[model samples]
Target: MKKKFKHIKESQLTITELMLPSHSNFSGKIHGGHILNLMDQIAFACASKHSENYCVTASVNKVDFLNPIEVGELVTLKASINYTGRTSMVVGLRVESENIRTGEKKHCNSSYFTMVAKDEAGKSAPIPGIILTTKDEIRRFARSITRQNEGRHRTSRFSSKIFKTDAYIHLLEESNSKIELK
Candidate 1:
């Protein structure tokens, strides 16, 4: 069979929900966990739509809560496929919160979720490649490739099997830490 290609916008998804008091933490801000759950759901939806198959999250990249969402705000999340491998895709998510009364908007989070399509037998399945027609789409694809390469390099450098403690111990001296060798 020939390989299939799709445009990123074909499967793009956007969802908006009102922040409720129940979703807030003790400090009265919307809980980070709640936002994360919504992000994961959108990621799954986007990936599934793009692949036309059931998908599961393989990993979640950096998630930093840049702004606190308050109760009564409208939280909107947008998801799009940034990169597509043979069996996996990177779903880019952007989260923003808007004050319903004042109409002020703030960026809350940006995250990347890696999802893999699954076959009926629960094995990895091939997914369609993405068509990059615009410069922004090309940049996102290239960024995903760079991120994956950096992750591999970081993992290998810190792998327990070959990691050298001495090489990193000196670096910790500059931080707020005390080194006591046994």
Candidate 2:
């Protein structure tokens, strides 16, 4: 049987690619959307490795661009699964731009992605829990928990306004029911 308890210790995925002519904007900076797409891809890979299943992005907790990447630079995306829940996994991603010629690297962006494992039927599926091994991993896990709690509190407070409409309320209720099933 597959091990029911698995710890994602030192998990990381990295991808490097040059900023092609097609990938640049008129201003010569890489587009934020492009970076975000790469971040999502890396995050999914990390989460899936931990969950041992296909994973779909549920939400992006945050995305911040610290610097602009030049066209000739190599963009490197690094991601790892930092936390997990019954049906969700939180993956942290960082993007760095390196000048291959000069061998210089700088952090360009950082983000957190939430992914849900999927079953054979393409429905949401439960994921095994994560075991924190190192102090840094434990701290990251704690931060994820804090973020999740904050998100829940914020949603609960404003959900009545956001989903107060009858149709939206119905949809929310249906989603909640499905989540409970998993």
Candidate 3:
């Protein structure tokens, strides 16, 4: 069977919600966990739309909260297919918060979610490839590949079977931690 491909725009999704007091932390800012939940939802929606199969989040890349969200602000989350593998896709998400009264917008977070398409039997399923139409799309696809490679290397380096504590023990000496090897 021939492989199928889809343009990045075909599966793009965007959602906006108004922040409320119920979603804020004790510090009066919108909670990071709430934003993360929204991001995951968008990622799932984008991936499922592109693959036409149910998708589950396999991993989430680094997430940094760049700006605090006010309770009355409108938060918008945008998701797009950045890269696609045989059974997985990287959904790149960007979040921004806008003050309703002033129309000022601030970037709150940017993240990459790795999602795997699943068949009705709950097994991983192949997904359509992405059509990179712009330089930005190409760059994002390249970034996802690089990130995956780095993740594999990092995991192997710290795996229990091959990890050497001594090799990294001295590196943490300056930190506020004590090494008590039994």
Candidate 4:
């Protein structure tokens, strides 16, 4: 029998931290790339735990940075597997910054990441299905499915158009040659 997904409580995963040095950025705030890297790590961890497989980030649907994280603040990344597809999983991540001394916390960013599990040969692998155990989770899952379908349609159209353009094909060939030589 297939196991049903239980509503994941906040206590399921601990907040993960990625420290940043002053030299990590010029603006004295945590860089967006740094935060994204942290988010990716957290997302992969959540997805792997949910699916029990090696998962890789396929795409980041959206990222909204609400506040800046200062150099000395602890950047905490929390993530959970919100939805799953045949070969894809959407993980929701929220990043917060907290002052170690004062205990003040602020929401720094939020993002949705799509990950794909891989098999031993690196092919796309099926992931365990997700069950909506709550009304909120059901709503969120529906939204994610809608968004993923829209994105897939858009990507398909874009790829078709790109394939019909000689310039793009030439660029792709050039890039491929560079990779081959390397």
* Local accuracy by lDDT, each model: 0.98, 0.84, 0.96, 0.77
Best by lDDT: 1
lDDT of 2 by residue, 1-182 (tens): 46365677545688998887678888988888888878888888888888888999999987779999988899999888888888898898889999889999999988889999999999888788877789998998899999999999878866755654545556666564554433
Stretches of candidate 2 exceeding 4 Å from the true structure: 1-3, 160-182
Cα shift from native, residue 171, model 1 (Å):
1.8
TM-score of each: 0.98, 0.82, 0.97, 0.76
Count of clashing residue pairs in every prediction: 0, 0, 0, 0
Instruction: Summarize candidate 3's per-residue lDDT along 44-143 as a digit string, tens digits.
Output: 9999999999999999999999999999999999999999999999999999999998999999999999999999999999999998988988999999
Show model 1 residue runs off by greater than 4 Å.
none
Model 4 per-residue lDDT tens digits across residues 1-182? 67445345531354756455842578677788888877888888888777677989989987888987877788878787778788778888888889888999999887898989888898887777776778878887888989988998878867854555554556676564554433
Taking the tens digit of each residue's C-alpha lDDT, what string does model 1 give over 29-141?
A: 99999999999999999999999999999999999999999999999999999999999999999999999999999999999999999999999999999999999999999
Candidate 4: lDDT over CA atoms? 0.77
Cα deviation in Å at residue 97, candidate 4? 0.8
